[model samples]
Every structure is written in structure tokens, then in C-alpha cells.
Target: MTQPGFLFTGTPLELTDGEAYHLRKYWKKGRQAHSIQSLAAFDVDVDLDALRTLVQLDCANCHLAHVASCCEGGFPFPPAAELLPVLDEHLDGIAALLPLDVIRHLLRKGLYERHLETAGHRTIGTFDGNCNFCIVEKNGPACMAHRYALQSDLNPMSVKPLSCLLYPLDLIYSEEDGRTLLTALTERTAAFSRWGPDYRLDYLCANVELRENLASADSPNIRENLPPDVFAPDSYRPAYVEGRQLLTELYGAPFYDELHTLIQGGRRP
Candidate 1:
């Protein structure tokens, strides 16, 4: 019997852009409630308290009922050296509770690069502080706060709220039926079945999630105007072919070759 052929559908996205969108959205919306509950009207730890104050001050006018659409798919706000003193003042409390150093490093790099293109600063990289996804190098040494927490024997990852831990993973799409779906094709079987063999892996690799997050947020128009950055060309790609290619890349010639033999000899699903 002939095996079932799968077709690819959906759009592709830039991985960097996806990461930026996730981070900004989480920072802007995901933590809003927490900020109100934990930080608002409090002045305990300098750093945490300051962060709470910042959130409260900024969100005093959060008129938007649904937060999902508010995120503009933008990069993180670059870390400001001006905020260093505030961070330093609350370092003890911050370091005690969370990965202060890591947070600082990421924020600083973001600031240096000016992700949002702040007023009077439209440059992309004046100091070339962008990370090429090398977590250890960019996310480590610069983060003494994170290192400090590790030395104290705390589960930093657990202490981190869902927003921080679920950075790139927050990518999801929502359907009219209201089901949330993950887009990362981390497995071969999944890639073949959900995304189609001919689907554009490049876009998939970048856009971890889809319209779901955008739909749930304040910027509902994003789903309609998500630009052809990743999804346009992907709609026509076949799943079986793309799946076969992905499988070959992951398992190598010997494994894929053997798998192909087995698949060809088996009945269609």
C-alpha cells in the first residue's frame, strides 16, 4: 500500500524576531498582575520593589482589557545604564530571590542595542552587543546575579516566573475553536504530521508560536497583519518531503536510509 502524503501549511517567521516578541510580550503583559500584587504599594527589596514600582507606574493606565493583543512583536527594551544604580541598590534582594545578574545582562545588552529604538537613538548596534543565540557566552559571565543564586543552591529556573522560563516557548497559535497550539517542530514525527514535509522549516524554526498568542493579546490585528516574514511561502510545502529532509538531517544517512526502507515497505497510515 502507498504511504499517506502530507502537505505543509502556515507561515514562516524569523527566530530572532519571534524571540523578541515573546520577551517583550511577557515583560509587558504576563507579569502585569504579578507586579500589581507583589510590588505595588510596597517598598521591601530595593530591586524588586523598584521593579514593582516601575511596572505600577507604567501600567497605571492599562485600559486594555485583554493583554494578548498589546504586544507589538518588538524586541526587548535595551538595558539602561541609568537603571544600574537602582539595580545595584536592590541587588541583595534581587540576587536573593531571582537571577539578578542574568536579568541585568540581558537587559543591558538589550539596552545597548536599543531594541525599541528609543528617542534620539535609532542605531541598531552601536557597540555590537547582540547575542547570536549562544546562551552560555551572552547569558552567563555577564550575569553575576544568576551565578550568585546558583552558588546558594536554589532552583533558579523554578524561581523564575513562567514568563522568563518560557521565553521562546511562549509561541503558540489560537484557533477560532479556542485551542492553543505549539509550533516548534522539535520532533520528526511532529514535523511530518503537523507542519507538512514541504513546509518552510526556516520560518518554523524562527516563529515558535503562531496567531494564538497574538490573537489572545491586545493587538488583535497582528494575526491579520503578521507580514509574510515566515508563513506565506510555507503554505505550499508538502509535509512528507519536508519531514523526510528533517529526518535525514537529524538521524543521518544510515538511520534515515533504514527508516525509508521500512516506510516504503509498510502500508499507508
Candidate 2:
């Protein structure tokens, strides 16, 4: 009588038992996030440099900078298998930031081919199973590749790679009848209004209520504020905006403009 997921009329979506299993375990945050769909909103010309500054300002406490203490080092969970070429192109740019030993191991092992065998989408270094590029600092883990790309004059997509550029925002690829579908979704948000307390507490999203609870007409917390003055040093880029940027990077400027126009017209993706 009841559905598997919660939300609107399509609530309790159709699912295989296996799919249901993971959905039960993981969809709290997901179903709530579906309410607004993070990509529905937009913030242009976000000051990524300012975001870097914020991460630096409170490096220890900010959880995003953390290493993979749970697993090996911090495998960036790289792009799909097919995009390996695009991912490899940036290795030269990021190599300078890595240790020689790590570099040597990566080269000796033959980069993607070897790592792909063991780690699947992980960016492993050496035979030790650690991601070659994650620099474990005293505070946590920092990505040399990401740092290099942000600072470099090159196009971030060409040099930065998708995994690093798109962290909190996730891309899901699926196949149904004949074609493939790619969906980008945010992990968590405080904007889950159509659900219950269990959903809000169990769902767990980031930066959702940050906008409402902090930003005001004046003296706003920069990270919580969106649609900020692009020229300002404190402009904060939301995951939604970055998702658009990532899409643009993968496709082109025209795709981003079309997507933006569609979203502005209030059509669902």
C-alpha cells in the first residue's frame, strides 16, 4: 500500500528489492533533496578563489578537506572508464606538486591501466593502494591536482578533471530502454520541507539552510550567500552552480546557456 520513497505523487517510486535496499539505507538525504533539486537555482561567476580561502581559513574543522581515513588514502573517485584520456591529460600539470617517489611509482606502474585493475575508479599511487595525488596534510587531505587547476591559467575542466571539480555534487549515469541518462544531484540539503523529522535528521544535507539561517541584507556569511556580487571577493558558489559549470565543461558554453534557460523557465530536468 505504501511506496518505497517519500515526497510527491510519484512518491514511493518503483524499485527492485536490491534497489529498495540501498534506497532505504541511502535515500533519506536523496528524497529530501529531490524537493528543490539543487540544480534548479543558479549563481553565476562564483569566486572559486574565495571558496579556497574559506577552506583554508577553517581547514581543520571543515569536513570536505578530509582524507580517506576510512579507506586507503583519498581516491578522488575519478570519472567513468571512458573518460580516462581526458583525465590523463592533466597528470602532467599536477605532477610537479606530487612527491618524486609517488610520481616514480605512478609512472613505473603505468598510471591508469594498472590502477584501474585494482581500484576501479580510484586514483591510486604506487602499489600501496593510496591515491597518488592526495596530499595528506596535518589538517586533513588536500588535492594537489585541484589546487593546481584552480591556480592555473588553463581551463579548469581541461586541467582540473571532473572528480575533483565536482565533489559534493554527484553525477549518476543509468540506462533504461535504449539510451543512457546522466543525472546530477546534490547529496544533502536543509530544504526538505515535504517530509518528516526522520527525513530531515536522517536525510542530512549541506549548505541548504546555510543560506536562510545566515545571510541577510547585510553582514552575511559569504559561503551561505548565493547570487552574490560576482566581482566581490566573497562570492560563494553553490553546488548547483558548480554542477552547471561541470556540465558546461563536459559539453560547452552553449549547453550551459540552454540548460540555464530551461531551468529558468521552471522545467524539470
Candidate 3:
């Protein structure tokens, strides 16, 4: 099965039968394993182990500190089919939120026309190393489209690219067994073929040790050189806990419920 083009560019990791089995074994640990196994009867499958390992990230901190942002990494324009609904329904709202210059450029360049010309697959334009739609803010860069959607009382996902929404957490479809796998970037997954780029090394959000080291540093230079509260461990939380809304939105409440049940040792309120 041919995978649909995503905003981000990366070869999807295809797991061999043996590799798949091993990955499953790696997941079958502790009480969570029982819940992971139970998911086979559900509509979606998850990489609970990988998700559990991702402890914390402060996106605002990362952006304010001028760290490498996924937005700055040029990504493809989501296929026209994926964008048409938004443009058809909310184009005016989006245009209203963007700077006049950007709107003028889009009009001159034929924003909708470009989607058709590129056959729904082309690199999105960038300015100053960030996505052109990004508005620079004192706190951080924000997507104008997303902001517009929120202001209009619309779902941000309706306008935001799926790739942008599902960062860190990767949804992989396997041709080998015809299964859809949900996983994330972890040390083990980074070593193996996994979705998205291996960002476990330097990205503060992905590296726990780096965050800890930065958080605890006492050197005068170290203290002065970095952003205030950069990589603060206090901001950290389990990936599952942090990603509750996204997970529920993507996989439905039952899927997230099962995950929560397993993580909380079957405790329910």
C-alpha cells in the first residue's frame, strides 16, 4: 500500500516480521502489557512502551529559547484534498489573521492554484527559516491558521496539517501485517527504523538527560548563557498524560481509556 504524502518528509519504517515480534515483546512489560495486548481487539494499536518513556517537553520554552523547531524544518504543503475543506470553509478567516503582505503574496501566486499545479505535493514556502504562516510572538512563534481557527471557534485540526498536530507521536501503517501502529521517538525506537527523524540526541524535549543537566547546572557561564528556566524538569510530564487530547481525538475515548487504565494500574474514577 502506498502511503499518503505527509507534510514532513521521512521514509516510514517498515518492520520485518522478526523485528515486529521483538518490538511487541519489548512492549509486553509490567501491567501495561496486559492492556497493550487487549488493544488487539480494538480498532487501533499503540506502542505503549515508547509513549510511556517520553517524559516531558515545554514547547513554549523550546521556541522562546530559539531552539530548532519542527516548524522551521521545511515541510510539504499538505495535499490539496487535505487543505481544500479548510480553504473552502475558512479561507476568509485565515486571510483575516495573516499579515496583509502574506495575503497579497498568496493572491498573486494563486494559493489554491498552486495546490493543483503541484498535484497536492510541494514544499511549503518559508520565511526567516520558519514556516511562512508562523507569526513571531514575544512568547513564541504561532501558526496564524491555527490561531484563526481558534478565534472562530473552530477545531484547529481542521486547518492545521496532521503532521503538525501529531509531532513526536508517530502513526505508522504497516503493509506487512496490515496493522496501524502508534508510536513515538524513544532511545530504542531512535536506534531502530521508526517514524520521524531521530531527535533523541539534542532536542531538549526529546532528551531527558540534557534537560536534567541544563536544569541542574551551577556554572556561572552556564547559568548566564541559557534562557531562564531552560529545560526545566518541573515542566515535564509523561507523554501519555500530556498527549491525552490528541490521543483521544485520533483514536477515540475507549483507546485512551484503555491506555489510562493500564498506566494507572486499572484505577478509574
Best by TM-score: 3
Predicted structure 1, TM vs. truth: 0.23
lDDT of 2 by residue, 1-269 (tens): 54423211111112344443443344333335442223322212112211111111222222332223222333444444545666577778788888888888877876643344323434434335556666656543255665577667666666544555543443322122121112232222112221212321221122333333443322211333323231122333443454666677666777566555543445544
Ranking by lDDT, best first? Answer: 3, 2, 1
TM-score of 2: 0.50
Q: What TM-score does candidate 3 get on C-alpha atoms?
A: 0.68
Query: Candidates' lDDT values, in order?
Result: 0.29, 0.40, 0.54
How do the residues 135-187 of candidate 1 rate in per-residue lDDT, one tens digit apiece? 22312322333344456575433222222222122123222223222222222
Tens-place lDDT digits, model 3, residues 244-269: 77778767898788777756666545
The lDDT of model 1 is 0.29
User: What's the C-alpha lDDT at position 183 in model 1?
Assistant: 25
Instruction: List clashing residue pairs in candidate 3.
Output: none
> Which segments of candidate 3 are over 4 A away from where they belong?
1-49, 55-57, 76-84, 112-123, 127-129, 191-198, 215-231, 264-269
Measured on C-alpha atoms, candidate 3 has an lDDT of 0.54
Minimum summed lDDT over a 10-residue window in model 3 is located at 4-13
How many clashes does each candidate structure show, in the order listed? 31, 5, 0
For residue 73, model 1's alpha carbon misses the true position, in angstroms, by 18
Task: Say which prediction, candidate 1 or candidate 2, comes out ahead on lDDT.
Answer: 2
